[model samples]
Target: MLKDEVLKILLSSGSHVSGQDISNKLGVSRTAVWKAVTALKNDGYDIESVNNKGYLLTKNKSILNEAEIETCMHLYDCKVFPKILYFNSIDSTNTYAKKAADLIPSDFLVVADTQTLGRGRLGRSWSSPSSTGIYMSLCIRPNISLEKASMITLITAMAICDAIEELYNISPLIKWPNDIVINSKKICGILTEMSCDMDGIKYIISGVGINVYDTEFPDDIKDTASSLLLETGTKTDRAKIISSAIYHFYEDLDTFMQTEDMSILKSKYESRLANIGREVMILDPKGEYPATALGIDETGALIVNANGKIKRIISGEVSVRGIYGYT
Candidate 1:
């Protein structure tokens, strides 16, 4: 924990921070600060210690820790997620978060290094390799009705797209409901699950899986999957992405909850909609049909021109590759 605190100080500082300053801030001795710095260096942070200048984080190479995430949150002045639960390995962050939603405080985050049983939308498997991607779930209890819950998914897509563009200057598009893509390849997938009663939602667990540094995907998903490094040719700080996403989500959450509709975010979300004006195949249970995507409605449903009729689809299997060559 001392190392995390020291790391927060080093990460937030633009220049070197004096050891005495750190000692005074954290109420620890210089020896303890030195030990914390040593531990951080051992954990793969590039920390430089100058005799007169004190310490600085010279470089960050895909480094992710609680302190770094907290530092990013502090930089954004966001306090939506009051507590963070981190794990080295787990079955699934969403699963863990759902089980602990009622037990822990509201609006807590669950992050994992790797997931043995990661899930995607429609019950598909999400690839979560160790130390190569971000597998996280944010558990929140919103008092919105079931009809308005889909807005959370759309808001999440916008949050991630904003975060990626702000951090890496790469434009990411939303593949309709719950996928974030860069250059037509999926860089992130979101799965939002909720527990509810007849009254309203008790908790919503939003699981996000991001490809950060993986050079290769599984043979099955290689064609449709991509990583941040592969897309931008640079390694990214996963914690910053996480913090930025949460920051943006909380930024728009108030208006969304107030109006309980997409009036505030409709245009912004449609600007990044990958399916606009594109021909897509809607996989209906009775039969498949071709349609042209017009955009999304105020309720976050995809509006499409099904031949001569206008249809607003809430959620189903829809393929956007008729325009983008992606699944």
Candidate 2:
């Protein structure tokens, strides 16, 4: 924890931070500060310590950790996520979040560098190689009904798009209900799970898996899936993206919770929707149908024109896809 505190000071200082200043601020000994810096360096952080100058955290393509993420949260002045729980590797952030749901507070984040058992929507495996992706889950307890909970996934997709657009300067698109894509290739997936009883809603675990640095994919998904590096030809800081996503979620969540519907947020979401104005095939359990995506309505349903007839497809009810291939 002292290392994290030292990291925050170094990051925000933007220059060398004196050991004495860190000790005074954190109410610890200078020896403790020196030890913290050493720990950070051991953890793969690029830190510089000169004879006169204190410590400087030079930017590098290091792995995701709690200190960097918390520093980003502080730099961005984000409020919703007060606590961040990070893991080097895990079975799945979603599974961990759910298991520890009652223990953790609302807006607590669970992030991992790699997932041994990563998952996606419709029972698909998400590729989660080491140092190649961001796997995180946000835990929240909103006082809304179960019916309105599905919209959280859409809101998360929009938040991720906000992060990508701002950080990478790339215009990301939402593939219908729960996917983020660039150049028509998916770079992220979202799975939102809710728990509740007759009383009210308990909590929602919004799991997001983002392909950050991967340049290649499996043979089966090479044609459809992509990463930020593949899309932008540049390496990205995973912590900043995570911080931005959390910030944007709180930004849009206020407007959404006010109405408990997508009416207020539908316009913004539709503008970045990849399925809008496109012909997509809906894979329903009953059967498949071809339709032109009109956009989402106030209730977060996909509005489509099916053979001159209008129909609204609910989230989790069906999978929408481009007629030619995955979007």
Candidate 3:
């Protein structure tokens, strides 16, 4: 109890504390206190000491290791994705999942504390640092079609956001097609990659990255990035959020499969739309267009109000960046 207080005080302030002060309050000898403080320093805490002064915390970064995340798991079905492959460093969770799914059991979860080659939709680079995020991928192989696989992406996005909403009570808006934004900045990014044969399907791997605790974003994305910590002004438990995300994901995926109708998912999706009814610019290989957002249709297609007529846009080289730029 006293050791924790001594460490907490040293961590909370930049100024040096004294060994005498720690011993006086904790009722422990200076040597016993020194051992405890030294132990915390060895555990990656940047504690500095002077001749008289006790310790001063210079920095504390999240060691986004797997033990902490696994400690956060609350799913009653512990067998479901129980084995998490935690990597200190990895190229990409999705790429690794794709390669590993051939032999690994279904529903195996792979989480990386840091990703060197993280990827986003449209081959964009996903910025993932060790400190403020979760980079996890799950391997799933369902007896579904190559064409109907869009539901997997939609359902997964909804599940992740819904779980966050349930746990943190901070609702994030969906940037239709994929991605979740809070305060007009991206908070979560989803990448769904699958290997399917012409006759049937092989496996589907879904990668999810959520920025939970962050002090800053990359300079290139500073204007367009955010984190749960930045949004709520409080530190969040990463394990709790990740467990909640997976649990909600399983529930929503089951419901989506049972219905076999995207209309049901579409309705629930609209309630969390970030670009609905907003002026937008489309960045596609076909150039660009001016359109008003009409929310997504049942097929997970973006409906655009172009020239007062609704155009149902299916798969194309499309990028919906908001014209008004407000989420």
| Candidate with best TM-score | 2
Query: Who is ahead in lDDT, 1 or 3?
Result: 1
Give the C-alpha miss distance for residue 240 in model 3, angstroms: 1.1
Q: Write the per-residue lDDT of candidate 3 for residues 1-327, one digit (tens) a residue.
A: 445566655644558888888778778898987887887767677777878656776765454445445545643344355466878789999999999988876577788877999998878898888756889897777777787777687777887888779877888888876788887888888899898998655888889988888779889878888888889887766666777777777776676677654776788888888888888777767777888889887778889998788887665457777865543
Whole-model lDDT per candidate: 0.87, 0.88, 0.76
lDDT of 3 at 301: 84
Candidate 3 global CA lDDT score:
0.76
For candidate 1, give the lDDT.
Answer: 0.87
- How far residue 104's Cα lies from its native spot in candidate 3, in Å, is 1.2
- CA lDDT of 166 in candidate 2? 91
**Residue 220 lDDT (model 3):** 81
Better of 1 and 3 by TM-score: 1
Look at candidate 3 and give me any clashing residue pairs. 17-54
Regions of model 3 farther than 4 Å from truth: 1-68, 76-82
Kindly list the per-residue Cα lDDT of model 2 for residues 1-327, writing each as its tens digit: 888888888878888888999999999999999999999888888888877788888865556889889888876756576579999999999989999898876568899999999988777887889888999999999899888888999999999999999999989999889888898888999999878987767999999999999988999889999999988997878998999999999888888988999999999999998988889999998999999999999999999999999999997788898875465
Give the Å shift of residue 120 in candidate 3: 1.6
